[model samples]
Target: MDYGEPTKLVFSLQDPKPVLCMNGDVKVTVEPNGRRKHWDYEVTGSFVQRACAVRSRAGHVVAQIGVKGMLAGKDFYHVVVQPGYDQAFVVGVIAILDNIHGESTRC
Candidate 1:
């Protein structure tokens, strides 16, 4: 696929990472390389999500995913992902992050 082309990819989490493919063939994972946490993240099979800050090699960010009434009717979240970066993957990671925060706040 060429740059600027739109290709939707769904995602889910079992642990660490897992993305539902566009063709619905299998669950994919987009984790950083071993011992590299803040490096490149693979969003499409083996494609890098970010070519630089605030943008991806696949595409640019179309919209953000945030929630209102998070605390005291406040809006929160600063999710940043490009259009063709597989929203499902972004959402899945967000879910995990939220879950971790929620669990941590429990006790």
Candidate 2:
């Protein structure tokens, strides 16, 4: 695959699941530098209980354990990815939301 091509990756959850725990569409723009690449995106939503791992086509993780949350009715999250680490980063955001809201469990 050419590293100069623009790519868009998306992950979504369907019905039977509450939208409160779902994350909105995440758009990643891949741009090429001199000998590396860069990625950037904006997230909009609340109560995101997901963990994502973004990797490249060569299996290099560009992002890991990306968590999304809300603060003062604003969307806030942290993406632990290092830019220009590799070429063609494939992101896989996993949802780990469960019925912990009504349960009393601590770890």
TM-score per prediction, in order, is: 0.33, 0.31
- Among all windows of 10 consecutive residues in model 1, the one with the lowest summed lDDT is 45-54
lDDT of 2 by residue, 1-107 (tens): 87453553232322223455455434334443335343353223332344545545444656554436755653344557677753223222222122222322122
lDDT for each residue of candidate 1 in 1-107, tens digit (9 for 90 to 100): 67452554332323223344422211223442345333223222211221112223343443344433356543355456655656655655555544633422121
- Whole-model Cα lDDT per candidate? 0.37, 0.40
What lDDT score is found at residue 31 in candidate 1?
45
The TM-score of candidate 2 is: 0.31
Question: Which residue pairs of candidate 2 clash?
Answer: 55-90
Q: Which 10-residue window of candidate 2 scores lowest in summed lDDT?
A: 96-105
